[model samples]
Structures are given as C-alpha cells and as structure tokens.
Target: MPRAVAPRVRRAPAAAPARPAPPARSRRRLAPRFFRWAVTLTVWGLVAGFVALIFFAWDLPRPEDALAATRRPAITMVAANGALLSTSGDLYGETVRLRDLPPHVPAAFVAIEDRRFRDHMGLDVIGMIRAAVANVTAGRVVQGGSTLTQQLAKNLFLTPERSLRRKVQEALLALWLEARFTKDELLTIYLNRVYLGAGTFGIDAAARLYFGVPARRLTPGQAAVLAGLPKAPSRYNPRVNPSAAVDRAIEVLGAMVETGVLPAAAAMAEAERIHFPPAPSRDAGWFADWVRDGIGDHAPPTSDLLLRTTLDARLQAAVELRLEAMLASQGRAAGVSQGAVVAIEAASGAVRAMAGGRDYRRSPFNRATQARRQPGSAFKPFVFLAAIEAGVRPDDGVADGPINLGGWTPGNGNWRSRGEITVEDAFAHSVNTAAVRLMQRAGGARKVGAVAQRLGLPGPFPRDASIALGTAEVTLLDLVTAYAPFANGGRRVAPFGIAEMRAEGRPIAWLPPGPTPVITADAAEAMRRMMAATVARGTGRAAAVSGLAVAGKTGTTQDNRDAWFIGIAGGLVMGIWLGNDDATPMEGVAGGGLPARLFRDILETHRGRGA
Candidate 1:
C-alpha cells in the first residue's frame, strides 16, 4: 500500500502539458459565443425581411383588376371563302360562377392542388413540409407543393420561371390575394383564369377544348383531368397523350376520393365513362386545327372575323359524315381504328375536304396532312410513271416474280408469279417484282425519287431497293397532291387550304391558282390510262364509280400496316388511308376493302348529289 501511494503521487508530479497559453484558450471560447451571436442576427434579419415584405406588398396589384386588361385569345376559322367554320382561341363560354359549378369542379382542383385551400391564409405550411420531406426521400422533384392560390397568383401576374425571387413573389402575391378575396371569390377567379392545355385559358375554354362541353357541365372525371393539366399542360394533354392523360386523371380521381370530394363508386363510374374530348359533334375538328396551325395565332377580336378557306362546305360535311359512318359500319368490320381522307381539286390544287379521323375531338391527329405513312403498292404509280417517262410503253411486257435485292426479297400480294406481264397489267395487279425490275430499268430509286419530287413529293428519298415499293413514309396530302399530275395531264399542283384570309373585315391575303408542269403529256396520259385500268378491272375495282372515270391505285403494306386508295375522279383528286395510330397490322384489310368503298361513296355523292 505504501509503494502504490508513492507511485500514484509520482505519476501526478509528471504533469500533462497544460492546454495552451491564455490566448488560444480564450480564442476557443470566443468561437461558440460568436456563432450564437451570428445565429441570433440571422434570425433577426429574417424577421426584418418578413416585416419588409408585408410593407412591400401594400402597393401590390389588387385581385379585381387582375383580369381587367388581360389579353384574351380569339381565333376564327372560316370555310368556303368566308363562312365561319370555328372560333377556337379565348373560346370563353357563358360565365361560370364557383357557386354554379358542379361541386366536383372546384373540389377536383382542391383535391389535386390544395386540400387546405379554404383553411390556409395563402401558402400551406403543412403541405409544403410534407412535400419537402417526400421530395427529399424520393430524391427527385416529385410534388410541386404550390397551393391553388399560389398557382392563381403566378398565373395572374407572373411568368412561369423557377427561382427564389419568383417563389417569393408568388408567395407574397398569394398572401395578398387571400387577404383581398373570400375563398369562393378566389376559386371563381382561379377557375376563370387557369390555363389548360392545347392553347386554352380558363375552365370554360378547357372544358370546351377537352370535352366540347361547358365548365358548368363538367363530369367528375373531366374535372379531375382539368385539375391534372395545371401540373403539366403539354405533358398530360389528352389530345397529345391519351394514356398519360388518363393515368394523371386517375391519380386526380384517387385524390378526390381520399379528400371525400367524390364518392368511390361515383369516381369509378366517372373513370369508366372517361371519354376524352367527350364524343365530338360535327365540327371542323382536324381541319380547323390545321388551319389554325397554318396561319399564325390570332388574337380574340372585338367583332366576328372572316377567314376564307379552300374547304368546300358541302364536301367537308359529306366527307366527315361518310368517314364517320364508314368507321362506325365498314371500318369497324374491317378492323380499322383510324382513317383520313384528303380531297383536292386537280387543276387548282385547292384542298376541297379533309376528314382527318372519325372524330376530331376524340383524336385531333391530322393523319392526312400530318402522318407520314408507307404508301406500299400505292407507290408503284411513281415507278410506272418513271418507266413511262423513260420510254417504256403501257403495253410493254415486264417479268413479275420473286425479286431478291441485296438479301431482301419483296413479295407480291397474290404470289401468282406471272413470268411476264404488260406494264398496265403489272401496275393493275400491283406486281412487286415487276415494279422493282421496272424501277431498275428506269434508273433505280434515284430516277423514281426525282419523278416523285417532280410530282410534288418532297423527299430525301432513300436509295435502298425498298423505295421502289414505296417503303418510305409520306403524308397523305403530299401523296394526293403528287397524284394531281396524273389527273391534270402532267401539271403539278400543290394542295392549298386557304383560298383567302380576311381578318376583321378587310382582305389580308388571297391565294391564287398555281399549277406547274411536272411531267410530259405522253407520260401523264400513259400513267392515267394504266391507273384507269386499275379501277376498271384490277385491285381498285371497288373504287370504280358509275358514269365517272376513276383512275386510282390500291396500296397494302407488308403485314397490312396501311391501306390506301388514291385516285382521280373527273379532275378531282382524292386519297383515303386506313390504319392504326400504333402502326399495328390490320386484319383482312386491303386498299380495296374499306378505303376503296369510302372513295367510291364520296365520288358517288359528288357526282350524283352534287356534294
């Protein structure tokens, strides 16, 4: 015990090096207090900022004048040189009050956007925190967390940019808005000022754009879709992406059910009955969209506008009626999901009628002018025309059989290998091998592509052997316009939709006729004779009209991806294409099946009833 006590005392005697000098010790102590003071100043600075912001917002714009001078879009379309076809932009329907809206309308916005719309002063602190946590956990920008008032404020008086300044301004404006108006008044302004997709502004325009109905008549599902569009207008637009839009709408509907804004069973029913754009009535659906796209956007006018279009009202109506009826009857039987028809006057190149689909509202996809489809055998005409121009006669004999070009074998429809056949018969029968061989004799795809270009087929024509068979995709408008040479005796005419444009009351512009010579008379006559034979006794027999000389060709792609019938009737060039949007193979469909019948029906109406 004595030895241990001595050892312990000795160890304490060997003292550790005392920390450092007084200066270092005091410096270490000073840091923490300085940090505390700095934090306190930061807190005070934020409080000062909050006070300054409250004073700064005293001069903020009021809510009543928010929309007073706001620009409203108004674009008008006319057919037949000045008959009002449609009015699209700023398409404000009757004024809809929040009190009058189907309760689901306002509720949908609340469910998807701001559940605390009524309770919160403006910004939702709880929702913002929740969204922040969720976004942090998800490692992405998942939720916007912007309340309805915030969105309304941004839309009313701000640009769509993401920055701290913008966020601060949005919050300040939102607070001002809440202070100025009651919940219902704010919702009314929001519903009346929100921008939906497809160039639409306000719930009224959105309802008309998506469902062809008024805001007052919005279904629960439709209202949910409108609510979804505010998040991403172009992304979830039903017209652009139906499946995506539907998915977004389903999320909105779920939000509604969770928020007790809509019943589960009612939501289910509404979900089941979600027909986007709500079965469009007889309106210029796709053509109107096309016209609007052609000319620059027009501002809403104080007076009715007049736009002189190339569309023949009678023909347009008949084309739409027949196109819809055929889809309902013949098209369904033929397993067709979509169809487009473009009729143009051969001499003038004026677009007479355009039936882009069964319903424009259901699908505003303008297949006629927009879609670039493989013409298949329909492209054989260009080959034949090239051959004819290269001094090959319509009666010239060409071998027809299996054609193996660069390891790619092109097959005929019937597979009946006629060793040799007349050029006219080869074209009429749509002999693939013969067309390829003829294309070779006519200097390959280069000459054919040049001929196609001359006939108004704009191209970067592929050099592969498949181009001989029209494997390249081309818009129906281009194809139909190119076929005009065959109808107008070698003159090329571009398809035109606007005859004249008169804004307000004065004429802004007028389109005069422009026809250029593309091919020789002999070549045109020979091709016309051959095409006439196609309608007379070959694959296009179904397209023949009584008492009217019809010259057309039938096209059916490999695996039946596309069916097309393009022809000329009494100097009227028309084309019809039937297919699916996904380019899936059709069942038991040929150019001669539904397309030919539709062509014949339209032609008959034109000749008989003067449509």
Candidate 2:
C-alpha cells in the first residue's frame, strides 16, 4: 500500500507547445501539387493515345470496299410499288449510290442530324464540349455528340459494341473517313448507312419502304419521319411503333422549324397531317415465310435476285380473312386448334393464296410449307392421277368387299364395304376399302409412288397400301405444285416469290420463266376429268366452285387428325387443310365441311373482287 502511494505521487512532466499534430497543413499543401501532377500525367497519356489513334486512322481502309465486302443482300420485301404485300422481313439490302441520293435528303439530314457537318473535320468541338459538360453533370453518357462523319465512321467501320476500345475505333474510323472522302461522300455514306425503321437501312429503302415514295419525293413531314429514326429505330418505326413514331415525327418537325428548314406553321400543319401508310397484307405471313425459306435454301447466290412467286395478293387476303372469320366463329372454347390453306395459279406456277396456320403470332411452323402430315383422302387424287396415267378408267369396277390382305383388312369408315363399286363412285364416297383394293390391283403401292415422283413431288412416297387412303405424308406446297400440272394442262411450273433483284440502282437478275412440262397433256386432261367428277358428286362437293370449271378432291386421315380440300377453279388451284399441330383430331371437322367451306368463301370473295 505504501509503494502504490509513492508511485501515484511521483510523476512530473516536461511540456512543449501543443502542436495540433503538425496542423495537417503539410498534407493539404502537397495534395494540390500531387493532383496537378496526376492531371498532367493523364493529359499527357490522353495526348499520346490520341496520337496513336491518329496513326491508326491514317492507315485505315476505305469505306466503299469494306461496305461492298458485306454484299448485304438487298431489301427483298414482296411489293408492287414499295407497298409491303406481306409482313415478314424478306428484304436483302439494296444500296443507292451517293449521287443518286436526293440533294434535299442530304441537306435535311445535315440540317437536323449534324448541322456543322460540312465545316467539321469529322468532329464537332463545340457540340463535344457541350456534351462533355452535360455528361459530367449528369454522371452518365447521355449525349452522343456524334457528328455526321462520326456516325458514318461508326456505321461503316465499327460494330455497336459499347466500350472504350470501340469508341477509339469509331474515332479512328471517323478520322479515316474524313481523310479518304469529301464531306459530300461521307454524307452519302452516312445517308446510306443510317437505319430508317420499317426494315429500312438507308434513305432510299426508307423512302420507298415506309412512304411508298422515292427519297426525291419525300415531303417535309416524311423527311422528318426519316430524320427521327436515327435516335432509336424500333421506338420510332412507323410500322412497329406508330404512336411513338408520330411523337418523334413532331419532335423532328420542331427541330426543322428551329433550324429554318421548315416554316413553323408549315411544320405544325405537316406534323398534324402526317399519317402512316397501310401495312401490307396481314394474311401473307405464310407467304413471307415460304418466300424466305425458298430463297435462303434453294435460291442461287447472285448480286441481284428477282423472285417471281406464285402468290396472288388479293386471293391471299381473301383466304386470311376467311380463316380468321372461321376461327372466330369456332370460339376460344374449342381448345387449341390450327389450320392451313394454299392456292396455286392453274396456268402459272404462282401461289394464288395460302394460309399456313390460324395464328402466325402464336406459331410460325407454316403448316403449308413445313408440316408433313397424312393427306388421308387428299392422297386419293394423286392415286387417281397415277391410275389414270397408268390407263385405269375412272368408271372401271373395283370390288369394295372387305378383303384380309397380309392380316391388314383396310375398310370403309364403318369397317364395312360397299361391294362392286366403280372407281369414280368409290372415290366420290371416300370408300377406303375400294381405294386399297384398287391400289393392290395396280402394282401394289409402287404405282401411286411412281405417279407422285413423275409429277415432281419431293421424293420417296410411302411404301404402304394405306398410301392410297391418303396415309402418306406431304407438305401443302409440294401437293399444290404437283397439282399445278393438272390445272396448267400438264406443264410443270416451279413456284417462286421474288420478281426481280437489283443493285445500287441496277437490275442484277430477273427471274426468267420456269421449265417445261413434266406430264403429258393427255394424262393431265384425263386426270382433271376424274378430279372434276369428285367435286361434282363426291366428298369434295362442298368445295365446288359455282359457275366455274372446278376440279378437286377431299381427304380425311385417321381419327380426323387431318382434313384437306385441294381444288382448282378457272386459273386458280387452292388447297385447304384443317387440323392441330399435335395430330389431335378436330371436333366433328372433315375436309368437306370446315376446310371446304373456307375455300369456297375465299374463292367467292376473290371472284367478287375481280382478281
């Protein structure tokens, strides 16, 4: 206790000034200099990078050859005069030379898209400075500050990657563009490269695609619509986002008014008057898919391609409307269902009308071109055609009594047989047993298969007697094409879609006429006679065309899984199929019922429309 007391009393301290830990003044004094040094280093690094970028830009290649390398297939929409006849994007690229681009078009672009475009050396310093300040304050990259040349550079030489390296590449390409081309040339590249919506990539395509007019004829309002697209095409595309596009068009008009390109009152009036043109046929969805597949797979590689397809736009519209109405009548309570229809020009290979499915938005399988299902009784015509070709008279008698052949006794719908029926009567009543009997008598199944092959159907018909009962699978297109011979007096015609393809401004290729006959005129005539009898007094009676020479047959597969009506009236050969994708049987639907009714409605509508 004594030691602790002595320790507690003992400490005396020597004190100097309270320093405040050197007042933190040293660090404060050095920080500014250090920061300055850091800034200077950064500036120097940026300068060095800029110099390196300049070197890269100096050596960059020209835009013309690079663009040519892509050989982007020209815009290929099926159109008569820039009016889309269908909904799918089948266009290849079609470039118009810079000189061909309207002068006003470029002027409008410069006025709204860049404004100091001609004077700048691929960069606008003032605009850049403004963008920089704005971005700095906003804390994000907002304003692009891209000059026309920069835009051209990005479009021609760089991808849309968002990175420092991509920006560097874009800048380098822009400088290169400026060095290699004049302002006018760069402007042209920019005009051609810019994406104007509605599947249009250039001014020319946009003018033609959206307004159904040439760039030279674009009014101020249309020009504004084109100008407004570079911001965000999907948002401003008149075809895709019409309301937003109208708003953007108004904004563009305001910009035009401010720039003195358009009078204020004029801009306002035109903005109010601006209206989008009607879209191409909503029903040609199936046609477009068929066109795309036809070109991508079988079309020859060429600079310009013109595809002359067998599609009749008016007829297609009629088919679509009829199918839509039929579906509506069926109601949603019918559960999941789908349907397909196709029509061919009797004299030409042209497809008159086609319906791939009930709803393309829900499914793009295109049953007309892609689905392969049993033709059921629809296969009877081919068998009949083959029998006729094989010299079997339509009135020739075939016993319909049930016969056990190889343990498979195919019979009529009721598993019973109508004995000693003529071929014509048997086909008219859709007697399966009679068809099997005839098929067995006529070289088993090979005769039908041979006849199909001879008619230019895609290869390998099924090797079963049931094929005569339409048990073999076939695409609607193939079936239609094969039937075209009968309607066209036995001449086989290839089906096509594109009419012609052109380059920058010139035709590259024009589809010439298809090849000649595959079947004898005599055989085709006799077959037509037999098929005509089917519509006149057979299962295809519902599809009969009133006051028109119509020949056709109806098919119903097992369990009503597939129902089809293929027919020809005057110059049109149409095929309609009704079913589900999963092979589910439709409710009380038969080829002669719903499918035939839809066909008749479409035919009658087109007949009235005078197409």
Which candidate number maximizes TM-score? 2
Off by over 4 Å in 1: 1-70, 90-283, 297-305
Task: TM-score for candidate 1, please give it.
Answer: 0.59
Candidate 1 per-residue lDDT over residues 1-611, each given as its tens digit? 56555344434466678876678779899999999999999999999998978765655566568657546446656677445567665544446898789999999988999998888999999999999999999999898788999999989987787877678888988988898899999999888878887667789877876776788998899998889999999999997898888888999999999999888998888888887743333447677777767665442345334466778777776787788888888777767889899999999898888888777767777889888888988888999888888889999999997878888888786659869999999988888899999999999989899989888888878887789888888999999999998888889886667776655456765555589998888888899999999999889999988877899999988888899999899768999999889988888899977889999988776656565
Model 1: worst 10 consecutive residues (lDDT sum) = 297-306
Most lDDT-accurate candidate? 1
**TM-scores across all candidates?**
0.59, 0.81
- The sequence of per-residue lDDT tens digits that candidate 2 reaches over residues 1-611 is 56555345756787776757755889899999999999999999999988987765664556677776554454355643334564233243445666665544665677767888878788888888988999999999877688888777776667677877667677767877789888877776777778676556678778777887777677878888888888788888898888888898787788777777778898889888888888776557778777766665343454444443456667777888888788777622343277788877666676666778887777777889888888888777677766666667877988888878789887676535656878888777778887777776667788888877777677567788877877667898788778888888888777666665444346655564675787788878777877888888877788776788878878778777777888888787788887778887777677877777777888899889886
lDDT of each: 0.83, 0.74
For residue 84, give model 1's deviation from the true position in Å.
2.6
